[model samples]
Target: MDNQTKQTVSQIPLLTTKAGPRDGDKWIERMKEEYTSLIKYVEINKKSDNDWFNIESNQMGTRWQGKCWYIYNFKKYEFDFEFDMPITYPETAPEIAIPELENKTEKMYRGGKICLTVHFKPLWARNVPHFGIAHALALGLAPWLAAEVPHLVENNMIKDK
Candidate 1:
């Protein structure tokens, strides 16, 4: 990771509890931690003029949807994204997707699930309960956008709006 990304990851607080939806009350506690960390991440992004996404979870806190954007060559490229927390969330990072980008790039899976770097899963494995949605966005999506958006634009896989 780059210095700026490291700094951004450091800014978002790590989640404390290791609870998933099946844990009942403990899951509630985990949710609180997730929201707090997300709020902090969003604020940091906003303050840095680097805000790139807006996300909200379902009532169960297991499904999330949002819009994410990349500004490349002074053009804004936006896409709607969503993901569902696996029953083993915190143990398994949710696979975030931009459905509209499906088949547009080789970096994505069949359903538009962004293919994380080979380094990502191992990193998440090491962090475990400490990593949350905020970390995923910072480490996963942000870098993917930085690397792929330029290629996508250059190749005409995506267009600026």
Candidate 2:
């Protein structure tokens, strides 16, 4: 019916793939409904061109240092990515690695590929909805990085204690 509806309909199939056999189809329908609501929220909250957030579009991805959830030097490590969702909303996780730290940590797995434990898991164990990517990145992955590898912040060493 509308562009937003079309996008939500399209995302249903992508979300379905992430579900298991018993609940996949039902989950897809539910996600499609939820995505429709999310689309409406985004549309209603669309910023004016003169708004500060909209005016700063050019600086969207640059590094900021006030309060980092997680910090790693992308220069030292390069990543290759693939995703099933649109570029604006990537559904799949990217792979990441650095040569020196390849074998020293559990976070990246032994093969040097970034794992997606937080990505696919439910947000709350109770009846609440999933927290999506931003929350997962902030709450789960960021804390995991800080706790599992404190040396990354202290000395940039994989094994420093």
Candidate 3:
């Protein structure tokens, strides 16, 4: 990631609670933290004119879907993205996908599940409860788009608008 990205991600607070959907009130506490972190992250991006995504979760905060974009050569390449939180949650990072790009790149698996960098699993494991959906977007999807979007555009795998 670039320095700007690192700085941006650092601005978002980390999750402190270790809770999953089955944890009841503890899960609610974790959701509060997740929303707090996500709100702050969105505010930061909007303030910088660098906002790249717009997402909304289910009432349970277990499923999310929205649009995300990358700008390359002044062209905006946008794609729809979605993910579901695993039962293991904070211990298991969510897998995000841009289904529109499913067959367009080798960097993704079937159904457009972006292949996170090798560092992601280890870092997420180490962070445990501290890494939430916001962090996953910052550290996983953001970088994947940064690295792949241009290639997709260049190869005509996707269009820019």
Candidate 4:
């Protein structure tokens, strides 16, 4: 990458984790359940319908990094995001972020982790075992996009589709 094209990212605050012991076996069990439900929800909501959104997850270690699309005003916009799990597993919700939109908003961390400072995190904490990628997408990213994307489009910060 050329120096002229190099990106400059501003630091954004991350979610501070609550103190807890790390359990590998528990993490394994939670990940399995989460991924299963995530796939099922995506298949049912995205694949089975003619909706304005779709997602396909490709696992990479503890993260679910994949393609996601949203149709706005009859145009499709495709982007990539990752759901990176912290060591705390179910004790803390995975950091779901759109790397492509980095530095565009204060709502996201410099590393592209979306800041779930609102009800999203609290809700997930309340239903740790049940909350998964699907819940994060539905309750977190989807709503964030619905709100922020429009502002981004208006300012030409991002393309609307």
Q: lDDT for each of the candidates?
A: 0.92, 0.34, 0.90, 0.62
lDDT score for candidate 1 against the true structure: 0.92
TM-score of each: 0.97, 0.31, 0.95, 0.73
| Candidate 1: regions farther than 4 A off | none
Residue lDDT tens for model 3, 1-161? 67987898889899999998889899999999999999998999899988999999999888999999889998888889999889999899999999988988998888889998586878889999998988999999988998898888888888776
Which window of 10 residues has the lowest lDDT sum in candidate 1?
116-125
Question: Candidate 3 — which pairs collide?
Answer: none
Q: Could you give the C-alpha RMSD of every candidate to the true structure, in order shown? A: 0.8, 13.0, 1.1, 11.5
Model 3 lowest lDDT segment of ten: 115-124
TM-score-superior candidate, 3 or 4: 3
**Number of clashes recorded per candidate:** 0, 0, 0, 1
Candidate number with greatest TM-score: 1
Tens-place lDDT digits, model 2, residues 3-26: 643343334212222331135465
Query: Pick by lDDT: which candidate is best?
Result: 1
Write one digit per residue (lDDT tens) for candidate 1, span 1-161.
Answer: 99999998998998889999899999999999999999999999999999999999999798999999999988999989999988998899989998998998888997999998586888999999999999999999889989899999899888887
lDDT of residue 119 for candidate 4: 62
